[model samples]
Target: MQFVKERQDAPAGFFEVEAAGLRWLAVPGGVPAVQPLDVSPTRIVLPRLTLARPTPEAAEQFGRRLAITHAAGAEYFGQPPAGWTDDGYIGNARLPHPRQPIESWAAFYAKYRLEPYVREAYDAGVFDDSARQLFDRVCGRLADDAPEPPSRLHGDLWSGNVLWTVDGAHLIDPAAHGGHRETDLAMLSLFGLPHLDRVLAAYDEVLPLADGWEGRVGLHQLHPLLVHVVLFGGSYVGRAVGVAARYG
Candidate 1:
């Protein structure tokens, strides 16, 4: 059988963290996770999945299982998996997953997740003074926010990472950690996941989301957008600014 292998020549413990994420997610049977066959500093090998078209049923199944997986819970906001230090990666971007002294999910996100990326973009000149100010407002208000318990998140759940096949939706290439469950759902909506409505519908049936969760999509999306701003270039800066503007 053919296998899929990911090779990365950067970071201190890149592949290891991903492999731990896959195992952590798979333990909850969240969705069909890529089989972690063999892992090494430079490579991770997994059994390749056959590609197929997506269906509502597949999407719904994915959603339901995703909720179950999330219900497994996490140690704390921004907590890393056991054995791995508080460090992670999102599409090659270094993510230092530090649990903030604050308690609220919004506070944790604002401090550890959003603020870091925004500051990075600012230092790199991707975010000008005006844009940085707007984003800072979002962070300030985060202390006033309340959210559900920290969930086992597929930290970067963008469309490219969710694969649809005959089996259902299988998640791959994750930056998994403890985070707000809505963050994953928000990411599923970001860049458009196929049958996303169906996915959310099924997920809601399994574990209902808080009211006005839809409105918070932009808020949860800020981190990834800023990540892109730092990782890529100017194109994502405007997108990040746009999302921050809405929250501000």
Candidate 2:
């Protein structure tokens, strides 16, 4: 494999690995193997693979494959390694290392994941008292149910994180962990990207999303938006507030 591009923004000591084990439903068997060799704290080497902007059909297939990957499931929530970050960002809400069993998704997300960030931001003055109260209400509603199944997630998935290669699509730089699959999909849509419609269509064809899945997108995105707000500052605060308002 040869070095192609370098990423400056990734957390320290991060690198992509070969796409294996997890079977992507859209691609039938799996994605073509590629090596993600670490070059430095913020760089990795990827073998050159020709890629073009995806067409609608291709995007849909990508979505379907993602759903299948999620369908593969996890033994328990929070199984993947915690995300690495500089400056103690603590992106995943300081959840218990090596995730333990939890009765419901709501409880897990509430205690181990969402609440911590809310509290941290509140304590730091990132959010006003009213915003904090609204967040609390949203968490309360989340406690009513667990996700249908625990999924092996690419915790920090986004449009740029997806690499469309000649052989197949690739997911890189994952904060890979077990959590709600929607979190991954939610991130994809967070920053508008091409081929999204196709991806969503394919995903729904395979997994058939629940009736109110659209409503939950805001909730799923809350974590990342909050992270961005905390890391980058007030620019993301409005977006975070918008998501919170939807849930409130």
Candidate 3:
């Protein structure tokens, strides 16, 4: 069986980049990615996946495997996936995937992740001047923070992207790139996941998270919230502002 996704009006390179992202995120002995069969500008064909209720055991295994996937490690922040050499998309928004490495995660994130969507939301009138200033303050704090090496990230790891099956979780619809691993984890938390506590615990056991990582969850969450504010304005504005206020 095959799953075919078609979007005739998709932006240029949409399905092509999605296929590239899935291929890039495929790591041996790691959580499985839904295999792409064929791709074109407007459509992608993938192996069919069956949905199942998530189990705690599967969640734990997914965590450990996800740690291995991140361990595959990218050369630098904002690096595009191996096959594709251009920016990608997250949901409906363009995601920055730069060729040049930015060694500083903070700088790369501030520039590529936060600033673009923030400015877009501000221009859309979803964000007021105060909200913009709050994100600015957060960026300043990031500048001073110690940086970690870039990880091969799933980039858009929201729970909906994880398809549970009899075998376990298979990742689909990635915005994969070289980025801070915490961003992926934070995204998982953005929308609730099944057995989330077990997932985080198992991941920590495989690769211990940084100290104060709990405190920094909101910081990592800012990007997605900002994206949401741009993509779907409404209560998302307040949600993004509240999270930014914590770090700002």
Pick by TM-score: which candidate is best? Answer: 3
Q: Is candidate 1 or candidate 2 better by TM-score?
A: 1
| Model 2 clash number | 6
TM-score of 3: 0.97
Per-model CA lDDT versus the true structure: 0.84, 0.65, 0.90
What TM-score does each of the candidates earn?
0.95, 0.78, 0.97
Question: What are the per-residue Cα lDDT tens digits for candidate 1 across 1-248?
Answer: 55755566657788889888988888555787786888888888887888899998999999999999899898888888656775889988988787443577776888789888888888988778998899889888774354677888889999899888888888898898898998999888879988999999999999998888888889889888888889997678888888888888
lDDT (10s digit) by residue, model 2, range 40-60 = 555556565577766676676
List candidate 3 stretches off by more than 4 Å. Answer: 144-146
Off by over 4 Å in 1: 4-8, 99-102, 144-146
Deviation in angstroms for 139 in model 3?
A: 1.1
Model 3's lDDT to the true fold? 0.90
lDDT of 3 by residue, 1-248 (tens): 99999999999889998999899889997889987999999899999988999999999999999999999999999888888888999999999876787758888888999999989988888888999888888888786254678899998999999999999999999998998899899999999899999999999999889887888888889888888899999999999988888888
Using TM-score, rank the candidates from best to worst.
Answer: 3, 1, 2
Q: What lDDT is obtained when candidate 1 is compared to the true structure?
A: 0.84
TM-score comparison, 1 vs 3, better candidate: 3
Clashes of each: 0, 6, 0
